[model samples]
Target: MISRMFSRFNISIGSVTHQIFKKPTSLSRSVIARKFCNEIARPENFATAGTMNDVHIKMMERIGLEPGYSPIPRSREHLIQYQPSSADLPPRSMADSFTSAVIPLSSSKSLQDLYVSYLGHVRFGRLMQDMDLFAVWVCHQHVNIPNLDKNIHLPYTFVTIMVDKIDFTDFSPKGTSDIRLSGHVSWVGKSSMEIVVWLEQEFEGTYKKITRALFLMAARNATNTGPAPVNQISPGNEHEQNILIGGEERKKRRIDHQKMSLLKVVPSNYEQSIMHDIFTRITRKDTIQLDKRVLPANGKWMADCSIMNTIPCFPEHRNAHNKVFGGFIMKIALENSWVCAYLHAKSRPKLETISDISFEKPVDVSSFLQMNAYVTYTEMNFMVVMVVADVLNPTGGRMTSNVLYYVWKCNESVPEVIPGSYHEMMWYLMGRRKLNYALGLTSGV
Candidate 1:
């Protein structure tokens, strides 16, 4: 029955062999790919604004730092050669990178106020920001740069390239239970590492699983100039070895999925048939005019179901390198997408999965960030929301910085979303592919 449901999508589920990397004699394909992507997808450089307001002052005070304090290092006197070889670094075990932190939501009312939504439930979007931060911390734990400055930031900067997947089993979090976040580096290539994080809540002296996230991060030079080599990791035991293997499979799947993107390839016969069926149901046979189309009883036009927001990127949300944090951008995007899903579903939707989020460019502080989110597709109780974030310039130009995709499930069935144009139809198909991969109906393209 499950297979039949996905037959029209032309999807097949399967697995491939895991490729483990030993100490490399030369640069690997992954490293070369990363370099090529970075060259073409370089972020626009914006001069840092010196404007400081009352809000900025307060934030600085709260963090026990002065307004003039910059997290960026003042000097590179601690000399280290650029682009170190991967084989030069020593191998570390997964256990060496394991890190954990507890959010004392149950004990601190002040903290709870920041995390709890008006609906009296923990905000999943805020949790996503924390998870992203935690994933970077885990990567730091795995990195062992010899003789680097201990007081200053590491000679390398770890940035999130992709959020492969975030799956939620239990979205509800009680205010009385403390939330714990833990993870380790599951896989490593020369210039990339995969960090797997777990979100759990305490109940009756036990930790119950809530969700698991896989983050793919790439290392760059401290100056944000180019790709930097990362240390290699070896599995310590059987379970850890299994995790390493899984990471390899995910990497392969990501490559395959990109190659099969709708922009790069035409739709298959099965997908075309499905799209035709949708068109037939929405249009009247008596007329050829698109204006004469009639929507299904519970259908909504995709164009009418969108939401947009403009936000000022402040320095308070900036990372150590002084750029707006990727995690902060993610939190903002998720909340906007969640609201779009709610309006489309006519009910509070639960986040089922974050299939993929790509950070194409770095967002600078003191810039205006704009986000547009809309419901692209729906099936039964599931909704696929896409959020596109761009940086706005004073000249009225826009540069796309990030694209995020989310899968949400509601308690009841949602209104079917109908595509009104060719672009929207492509978005519909892309959403379907994301949903299929998230539900394990497909092994990915």
Candidate 2:
């Protein structure tokens, strides 16, 4: 039965692609194949492995043991040093960390019900959550610490620092085919790893690409107290070497972008001119009066296109480290931004791309999370929405947790968004930069 299931799948690692027809004699040798049997066939097991703690608990349960029934001491004192050098661990190949999972939406009614949206299209936000989880799992596969007992829990904790980008194609799933999630650890730094994951759906006996995502993750100690060292990546072939080079370029771009942030530096001459043009179009020059700005025809004020939502971070949404799951926060932010775009366009919007998402801080599990979404920039049918997530404290103070940017495309052209204040204009410029990046344009209004 396992062999029959394996015959229908194709796995790609770097530039190499192969089909596995024979089932592995041992489950440890083929984690993806085992995942196909345990997770694709039974979606309930996928839900059980949502977090690392859950994964460990489920494994214990599979061995006919109760929860917290560990024979070895799961303490920090008994194990090796908390911080291991890179030399202490062996370098891993890109294929060594490659992993894949299947969401059989076509065969499983329950999965379809969970992933399909009201418009009969698969929910992109839910897929973002899955991608985030899959990236972490791939990193775990790459990391191998030395002198650590197998019976005890892993001493390293992987946390997502940022998502470099998520680019989507025109292919949309109709809930009639199985979706495959595959990725590998493409690059590794001293303590950080770059994971490249892609999504595809089975179509006419072939897999059609849906989207690709790049995630940056950092390793921390078991208690989430400090940085932990991770294994290095050994590029085995030319294709893998190119992937490593791309990762280096991405890291460089991120640094350059930070150096040019609006918060630190003034806007460029071109950006300032664009802002001036919008100001002149909306303001009356004849009067020397305050508040002379008036909304132009076919224009919507940036502040007016705002949407807000508040959610309580429950324990169920916490990750293995008892902090709010980064994926949950991403899903919420995307949904909020989608609503903002929908209201601004007065039509259902299709997500074109999600720009770089940086997790500023981890939210407490019991905190109240608030999200503010604003349509900051628009060009014809494309709208750039920014979602700001903050954790609200009991004393009425809030700390920024995340700032996400998304680009949405409507069926028809939408009204232009005009910035009224200086801060709004900054947001407008930032939104334009993000939209340009998403659209693969170097410069644009």
Candidate 3:
């Protein structure tokens, strides 16, 4: 059935043109933390202008950082890049240039300068991107049928946008950033929609526009769109296509990523899946590596690998100080790995300890971070996930590396492991474990 969210909203596509975005210092962790400390050291009871000051309060107490944390700010910067209605959009399919360049983004630019300039513009971009995406969803949800109520309802983030791909102009400032995003969506299934996102960069303004990408997203028919069946996008096809799928697709039972619903508030797993989709869709990655784990009946499991992008990083991924926010990356890498582990563990096992995890170098928020994870040991109902981070640079050559380690316990709580699945699961886990160990990857927390 057409979603209610789609049914209630108005359906006219609109645009805010010739807009600019400014970086927000308050959006950064360092700045937020500093402000958080100054405001309320203990981070006790507080109010954030009201809705959920408590969540932020708890966050500060637990992580000693501001509870106002949101990756939305980074996403906000992304909105401005859209071709405004009054502005010109590239005519060619936007799939040509594909490469990542590493450049210095934190050139001692003060947070005040970055914030004043970036955030101010960002607000405009945010308003524009959101309005456009909303407009598209508003229009599409109507099915454009007559006799329909102009009042339509769409689940939050229910619209899907795809236009002919256009040639991308090198937008990253020299010595500032090395990444730009490529977006592509095709009309797939009747109700299901598919999108392709890639991250690319240019250093000398000389490299080929792009030839590779690895990112993609799937949206179905709901308040939130589900996987669509478009000929142009194939989440399963890695080598030929240039994008990553945000949600994981499993055979027998649906993996958490694929099992999304907006009936009651979106499920947590679904939310994560959607978030991944936004990032992948925004970046337009060519290939994506996912971290996964599984538990078996006889003794086996498998974990999807991490996503590695040759594309340079954008300022959005960095911090006010320009350093790749270790915590943010760590959380993303870890959470994704955990989800992969969950996929591998069909038996629904419990969490175990995180093996040795370490960060090699300080990744610049502006440089791309190549990350991956894997699992091995089916019989033991155990899996180890690893992550590798490579920093991209436009001039000095790629130079930084980081890694993560995740350990999952197959049968910690249950006495005999699940009813009839332990034995077979053991076999699978053991085989995967061997493969993971052979890779000789570094570990991380």
All candidates: TM-score: 0.83, 0.83, 0.26
Name the TM-score of candidate 2.
Answer: 0.83
What stretches of model 3 exceed 4 Å from their correct place? 1-317, 347-349, 376-379, 393-400, 411-445
State the lDDT at 383 in candidate 1.
Answer: 93
Each model's lDDT comes to 0.75, 0.75, 0.32
**Cα lDDT of model 2 by residue, 1-445, tens digit:** 2233225335232211233334334433223322321211111112222333343354333222343323342445422364567778998877777767777787778788978988688888888887887888777778876666556666666789999767788888767578888778877888899888778889899888888888999988765677888888887665566677667766777888998999889988756766667777777878877478878888888989999999888766666545788988999899899989999999998899898899999987879999999999887688999999989998878999999999999988888888889999999999988877776543222
> What is residue 28's positional error in candidate 3, in angstroms?
43
lDDT of 3 at 145: 21
Q: Candidate 1: global Cα-lDDT?
A: 0.75
Q: lDDT (0-100) at residue 344 of candidate 3?
A: 63
Candidate 2 structure lDDT: 0.75
Candidate 1 lDDT tens digits, 329-396: 99999999999999888898999989899999898887899999989988778999999999999888
Number of clashes in every candidate structure? 0, 0, 124
The window of 10 residues in a row where model 2 has the poorest summed lDDT is: 36-45
Q: Residue 97, candidate 1: how far off, in angstroms?
A: 0.3
lDDT of 3 at 32: 40
